[model samples]
Target: MGDDAPAALVEIVRRWADDPSLLVQRAAVAAICEPRLLKAEGAAAVAVDLCGRCTLHLVGLPLAERAGSDARTLRQALGYAWSVAVAADPGPGLGAFRDLDTSDPDVGWIVKENLRKKRLARLL
Candidate 1:
């Protein structure tokens, strides 16, 4: 889906990011985090946007709602996925990451995790 039509892939990823299922949300991040796919024109921006959306969803959930294995998996995927998108296009990618509400613990953790990556750490 990302090869011939990255925009369509982004749209689908957006929907998946908003899905109620945490695994589906994880899939959204995983799908867009592919380095090759992110190299596509404009794909990095969409990837960052979807990451932000998924992060927001996770942060908004109640504590109990976020404790499941699926949520943990999503969080783990997001830990490194942001760096991939930012590395692909730092301009919009970093801008989007900065736009996130990091005061939320989950969002803060995700930000910190991504910042730990050498790719994104070099930007800071």
Candidate 2:
């Protein structure tokens, strides 16, 4: 089981994409792991400081706190973390959507849950 944070992060990022706050932006950047994506410093620059903490939460800190035992779970967490950053990019499905500021409250937590499922698939 992936627990709740992955879905929570997805929902939180979905909100951020429409609004693009420094906190959300930074969290996305921290989750991002792709070298090519990270190379585009302009995108991640908004949250340099937050990235460090976010990285820990996604990869290490959270696991230590909960005594996370499953490698698959950790890997899935990594995948979701990267997804949050990737979704923030101005491309694909996310690019088509309005800015994070747009009120799509109807989007609901289901989308967040779906994202969690997709990330877990990567581990599978």
Candidate 3:
């Protein structure tokens, strides 16, 4: 499962990929799992793609609250998603956050936190 699990799990995430209503939960699950899959053969692309999509979903939201999880999960999931994206390649897909100044404080805080994690990832 470790070798092929990310792709399999990504197929599950793709099922809800187009539904804005379900994006948060789907992304939360992906965020929780994808990072571990990053080193898996052929898993990086799928995990990065999922994280990119999830990051876009978070950016497009007016507030992280719009992701609809109880508050804490929403914050943590977005952070994890961002970390996966940055750790993947730090490209525009996720690195784009470096250029924005969102009006929402929650969004701002989470982005900053994710960037911090990204830096930590690089350090380790």
- TM-score winner: 1
Sorted by lDDT, highest first, which candidate order results? 1, 3, 2
lDDT assessment of candidate 3 = 0.56
TM-score for every candidate vs. truth? 0.90, 0.24, 0.59
Residue-wise lDDT of candidate 3 within 5-74, one digit each (tens)? 6557656665554466544555534543455666665455555555445545555676546646644554
What TM-score, to 2 decimals, does candidate 3 have?
0.59
Give every collision pair in model 3.
none
Clashing pairs in 1: none
Q: Which stretches of candidate 3 lie over 4 Å from their true place?
A: 20-33, 58-68, 92-94, 99-101, 118-124
Instruction: Indicate whether candidate 1 or candidate 3 has the larger TM-score.
Output: 1
Give the winner by TM-score: 2 or 3.
Answer: 3
Descending-TM-score candidate ranking: 1, 3, 2
In order of listing, the candidates' clash counts read 0, 6, 0
Candidate 2's error at 67, in angstroms? 0.7
